[model samples]
Target: MAKQERAVRTRKALITAAAEVFSREGYRTASLTVISRLAGVSSGALHFHFPTKSALALAVEEAAADRLRVIVERCEKFEQPEGPIRLVVDASYQVVEQLAADPVLRAGFELGGHTVEMGSSGRVCDLWQRWVASVLEHAQGAGGLRSEVVPGHVAGLVVAVTAGLEELGRRDPRWLAHPTLTTFWRLVLPQVAPAGTSVPLQFAGS
Candidate 1:
């Protein structure tokens, strides 16, 4: 393989290995030696791709962010005839499902909260909040929000609830299930969606 292609594979391998270690052992305890061993790459090769454990963690977090962006974008494609509120709900549900299945994404969120040890990768939870707020703001601009509802407040609530679910999922895998998220949206949609608008108990494309 060419140097560039080799580098790409090495980097991907390192990130994947890092995700497994971080998810299984967490930021403080996960070792680069184990990560290199898991990737079946030499220590030099791991260093060539990620010079430090923090660098590898950052890479994993970046990949997770990209995955989340894809999730939200996918929700945009299947726009419900109902409103933007439904779009946000579906998007949030998709993220929960993705988090449950994808250990990499889950690890990204895990490492994100470990900023004290992981350097300055920033909080993935903050990214999640901003994304939720942006989606809710779109709904507000489209007049889909309830007359009494504040878009920012609702967005914060969504972030807290989803984060709580993700945290719970760390302990009990069932917290990441479809019914768990659907139950959340089922309660949220009725309050946020315009009065008399029949928000489905189950989200579309669930």
Candidate 2:
């Protein structure tokens, strides 16, 4: 039991260390020696768990994907007062929050955009864009969206804005704060919401 626990801890440490190193140096330049050293584990242990840097990078990407999945699933389960659009807004807030707080997520997103030779798992950004599109489709069906709103175009705009904010937040973390997204929704909600709908700016913009 003790040995199993230690192994889990070691694997986790290696993944985190690898994420940090990969995020800082890029996949091509990241050193196994640096990862192992940062993880405080021997190279032997890292090799035992990951075999190769590509395998380790794949694990990091999977882990990051899982985190994003949790955020979306959580929003789906929660009943928002303003319906799908509000849920989308809340989900965006949660994503920026996670990106700001979690290095593994940051590294995963960074790595996703890079030309790493990891296996065939889709990029996190692509996954996120698909999710946004699906949510907007739901909103359109439920009459939550304006009649003129094209779900695909709105999805594109939301994805582009969120992706831009994620990049900007790396240089200035304030870009990821609640106010950033709140203000965004404040401006965008009226445009996207049904004509007669009153956007709850007070709840979100506050």
Say which candidate scores most in lDDT. Answer: 2
What residue pairs are clashing in model 2? none
Model 1 lDDT tens row, 160-186: 877788778988998987787777777
For candidate 2, write residues 1-206 as lDDT tens digits: 99999999999999899988887778889999999999999999999999988888888887887888999999899887778887777788788889898878777788776624545466777778889889889989999998899988888888788778877877798888778787887788889898777655433634
lDDT computed for candidate 1: 0.81
Task: Please give the TM-score that candidate 1 achieves against the real structure.
Answer: 0.89
Error of 2 at 4 (Å): 2.3
For each of the candidates, give the backbone clash count: 0, 0
Question: What's the true lDDT of residue 116 in model 1?
Answer: 40
Question: TM-scores of the models, in the given order?
Answer: 0.89, 0.89
Worst 10 residues of 2 by lDDT: 197-206
